[model samples]
Target: MNPNKPSKYLTLVTEESRVEGKKNTERNPKNLRKHLSSIRLSRKLQSGIDTDFYEKITKKFLDDFYPKKCNNPSCEERILDKEISTRPDIIRCSKCHRQQSRLSYTPLMGLKLPLYMFGVVFHESFLQFPKVITATEISKRLGIEYKSALKLKRRFQLFCSDHLPKYKVLTYRALEEEYKGFKLNPDTETDVAPKMGLKPYVSADACVLYSASQRANKGRSRYRYGGLTSSIFLSPKLGGKQVGTLVHGICIQNGPAFFESVSDTKANTIGPLLVEQIPYSVPLFTDSGYPWLYNIYKNHRSVNHSAKSSEARYKLARNRFCKLSVHNQVIEGSFRLLKSSFSSYCYIKPEYSKLYLDEFSFIKTSKFFGLDCITERCFGSQFSWEGRSTGAREATVVRIGQEKYPHRRSSKETKKWLIQAIKDRKYQEPEREERLRRNKEQNKYDLNSAEAISRSRKALAGEMKRFNDFWSDSQKSKHKRKREIKYENLSFKIWNSIQYYKESSEENPTVQFIADKFKLDKRTLMIILRKWLKYGLIQKRKLFNKESHDKRVDFSIVLKSDSLPHLLYTQLPKNKKIFRRMDQ
Candidate 1:
């Protein structure tokens, strides 16, 4: 476009024309020497392979072949100048053209660094690396730039609170070995009887699950804080040798202005929480600390050595349940472990509580199967009975999305209905004012109940005396069999029922009498009776005696009056002929 110079398109052609046309000037010997010398110098420069030189050559080549142009539609200015070999980062145009700098979109357009670095930082922080430490610390450890590390840590903390799984299962194994025997501390007088296996009761108590807490103190005293403690239920199965899933966990405390505290001392707090969370009519076996609770929830049973008569306690001291002190001790052990392992939980940091639980849920599951396993194994037979009897009840909303639809009216109405339904359907009415009234009345009436108390005391006294009489015989025998065997085997009658045989035309003995006779518990005897009756081991007929309460029965078993009655019980296990193993 320059007027004074040859047309830009004809420059190459015009030069070649001159090179061909000119003889002496164009083909001069001096020119030939200069050209050959230039070629040699170029070869020498190439021989060294200097990286900087190569870069320059590449820049020159790119400039000559391809003129850089502004990508911005608003700017028509070329990045390369008129001199094909010369180019500048900041280019200008005489036509009043504007130039816009192009941005690199490969690493998130307009970003100073790659987006991957952001992800990297977020990921590292999510892994819970130390945050307060300088970026240099991370750089030294991960071998990255301090700047990158710093950015990553900052961004990760900002974004990763909700994405991670609250809990994860690291590992688990079936706990058969720990279930081999009950945990009975013979040295401790506090322990109840050890029966099934050692682990029992995963301890969980109600507390504020989440709430605001006093973040700062005033003057000289600590500020009152708002916070939550979850109602936690833990059950140790088979004395904690075997564990199960988290059976039930309820979060009861919620507030915007106040922090709520839940303690074991709060009466019925745990009971209601348990009922809300667990879908079973499970018996809550506890220690003496919860007499009030036990008094209320009839299903709640307590094992108190102090409450027992001296002889009875002594007799039961060696019994499995009493000897082991297995009653509800596992829950206490779990509490100790939880407090020890998670020291942060000591004061309950509100914000970090859930985050802590995220890690804890996984760790807990890994350590002791699911939370429910702890409850199931600790409660054992009762858990099964409750689970079955509870039947298919209403399902609980465990997570947010389990609800199909969520809205204000629906939520409020549902909540209203739920609260009313829970109150209405409770095993007993909440008692509200009635409980207070009854409590006051009972306090006064306790005096008049002296006769009843005396009667109960006297009956208990008689029972204790009888138990003591039997206990005294133990020291006299050089080789005394376990007194339990006699009591269970009916060596002495259970004291209430007397057996009578029919002298006239009659039927076989009822299963109940046969069970009573063998001293087998009703449950054990029932199975044998079914088997005997199936094989026609006894005849069936109806009869009545003075004590008979209508003894018509599906006759199953008849004890041989001549056979050693005790042997029938003691040898029953050994003699396969007595009862066959039915299909399980």
Candidate 2:
């Protein structure tokens, strides 16, 4: 129905019903496309218009408004005439139905140009604009006038495409009609996500969008900006495609969220973050870019592709590798398609590069999959920071694997350790213990009265030195001060509390995390750990016992009876000789 047409219920009647509402309204049914047709006709009627120009404009108009089905109001036909009905807004047979594509009502609706022109522009941008050929060259290839090409470029710039997120979670009820052979009915039940009440370990990776690095203005070219799109994919065990959610995703500059763009996304990030927000422990999977991302989770696992492989390449590529290795296929495929299909998009203006990439990310996700999947896949769909708020918790259904998980140990063991530490009274350091002790010894320094406690710069420096000294040996103190509280205790505490921040997982601690977590001399601690590992402890499996090999070294033999028995002596090395024994 035309919104512009007179309303049957309202009083303001403009065009006076060509035929009364109940009286032969079918004679001239409402055709909203008449406006677009009028626009086309007006363009055709204009003087000085060339035949090529008319055909081009006419084609564009038709393509833009074409329908896949008969949109005519009077046509009550059930069976569709695909060929005739699929025509553009132009009439077919006596029916004269308006045509529409599935995308006509979407963000693509406002576009005024044809799809061929748009598709061509889209493909060209992926190759990176301002490279092999100029926009003029593109105009020649598309057979569009230079002005028309420029107009199409502007429209593409303004036209919004859809973006689909690589990661998506779907419940049994919600995941209907998505896959080819899969069915989500009552009888077709499968083990869903967060299996064993554990949190789902999702791996997130990002691909850089090269096409978004276009120069804004006409004259100069700058390609400083690009889009970093991140995806979080669920593992196969948890119902694979059947049960999953694209929990988070975002497009941003190259930063921590991207893990420096080495290769794969870190599942550690996805696991811990998901666990915190949702309920349960999540064993995450990821690439070597974030070797420790899995450790951040309360319960997690990982496979580093950067390591060497001893097996055959073909065998490794097959079922075993797929099952063992957590590959981000969806994210990887998205990158491949973006690069192949839209290479020309790279020629966007530098200023709009960021904006275009951001929108482009959304467009791609939405186009392939619907908005629902996109929402579940991209974390930053509604929020930012790669879809996670700085302080937001993960879902409970996820669990982050830890080196020394607290749940793995008995409660009695944990309690015993804490009690022993308290009994030893070795918790935090005493700040003013020395001053108080000295005051107690002197009668002139009244406990109630405030003495002249002005600190000298030199004294302050000395105090600082002592503090540094104490901090330097904190690891030792942490170990020896209480036999019950040793390295395992330390590892346990760290494993439990570190969460998904960069600190808890990396082999080397970030300065900030170290400085804040334990007031220790980080430099000294690092040095000590490194030196001890190299020099102190031998490999546990090595077998070498000097004492065991020479058991007779500790025993002295004194012959009692025979003279020959008394003639025993040790053999010396090289020129050194034993005492010459002669029997009488």
Candidate 3:
């Protein structure tokens, strides 16, 4: 019926088919092309997981872990030319006949997985820098157990951590100067010292990771069984208890970045760290919060984000474009990246924060160096497994051989020889015993002699005489009495008396007057005054005795203004007995 004149049903069906085809062709070309390419890419990648891929991985494993030279020191011939057997785990040196296992000393030692699976894991985890692949993902993708994938991933992380290069900007001389409280010695030869000019800028800042609040029971207690028992409900009050880890991060302009977990961001903690990590000559950019940065570094500049005045804001903006422009945005961006990386983990314990930071630093450093350089480093000899010595191997062989034999010795001839050696020792033993007996008798005869007794008595008398000369009873008692007195308390009292004299009278207090006032021993008072003068807490001035009309020198104690705060804040004992003897 539809052959000649198209039926309504047929026309409707044709129109519907045409519309569906048009809709399919009209789909977003960009998304359609991307979807098709991804499918092909995935298939190609999956196809690569074949025998050739395994062989390539095995070859690489052999190249990295195989011994390069004969272990024998005398015969260190290059073993690279030697052909690896089917079981490439162990290789033998052609010249020296020495054998070594490929995995002996490497992080891959004791690996139970196939080399291909391990290679896959390595390719996914290490090759993909800045892109994280969790163990669960690896397990799902590679069809391996989660525990195995995790172990492999952790091994790679540890390897990277151990072999990561520690970059230090400051030289040994600079570090020494910083350690010595930044005191410049005039005698130091500056002409020979290398000049570090126009050093690159380094920016430093800190960020908190895994910040979360703990929950507490906020509900009221309810009675159970007619008030016989009570139960407290936990309502989980969020934001009541907060916890986070403080991490200090630093990054050089167009260079690698570093991170460290710190307990605090105070000057005392971060100041020395900055000096150690960044050179003093280099310009440092930081926030206005760290006011002490100016005191620490000579070329330090801080940006005040909260500046209200237009002039101040304009100045900051101008500084950003000027010759010595300063900004810490590099470190700020690095912290943002770091926090993003940490976001992948559900929770990071405080103790392991350093390890995670090390990983982050390694990733940043690898980015700077590129993936090829990182691959070479990971395969370098530094990360190789250390093999056991030949002597140790021989000892193990001997132990196994002895275990195999019932009598320890292999044959009756060895047993007979051992028995003969033992008999020879037995024959010598008697003669040795006889010689010992004769020596003992001679010693007893010597002890019983009158000369021996007199010699012993003379030795004892000499020791007693020396002991008395070195440490007499009177000297011991004097030292003990002096040690019992609190020198700190005595010094404070003397300082107080000097202050009173300075404020109340025109003349300063003399040592003899203070000694008489405190009833302190003249010798002890001199010792305390010497310490005060040495520490610059007090100044000593020589005055002429006008009353005697003679050129006799008398010293007076004058407290220094610089040390007044130290004296004022110095803690003193609460007990009055400490100052009783000095007061008397």
Which candidate's lDDT is highest? 3
- Badly placed stretches (over 4 Å) of model 1 are 1-202, 205-264, 292-299, 303-325, 344-359, 366-584
Off by over 4 Å in 2: 1-202, 207-284, 291-301, 309-325, 344-360, 371-584
Residue-level lDDT of model 3, residues 1-584, one tens digit each, is 32123232122224565565556557855555655564454444442354346545655754543335576777755564355657656666777767776554454556677666666655555566566667787777666688887766665555445435432321222233333332211111122112223233468887777653222233423222121011111122332222356678888644568887765555545666676776564556687656545334544556766544447545444343222244588798888777777777766655556656776777665544343332322322111111222211121110011111111121334424423322322211123344334423321110123342344345333433432333223344655434433554355456655765676677898877887787778877876665455445577877778886676566888887422211211222256232222221
lDDT of each: 0.32, 0.32, 0.50
Question: What's the ranking of the predictions by TM-score, best on top?
Answer: 3, 2, 1
Candidate number with the higher lDDT (2 or 3): 3
- Predicted candidate 2 versus true structure: per-residue lDDT over 25-115, tens digit per residue: 3454565355445445543334222333334443443333232345555675322323333433233323553433433322233344544
TM-score of every prediction relative to native:
0.27, 0.28, 0.45
Report backbone clashes per prediction.
Answer: 57, 85, 3
Candidate 2 displacement at residue 349 in angstroms: 6.4
Q: Give lDDT: candidate 1, residue 443.
A: 18
Who wins the TM-score comparison?
Answer: 3
Candidate 3, clashing residue pairs?
105-385, 105-386, 106-385
lDDT of 1 by residue, 270-357 (tens): 4554443322322345565454442233233455544444574364443433333335544444444444544433343332333333
Candidate 3 Cα lDDT to native: 0.50
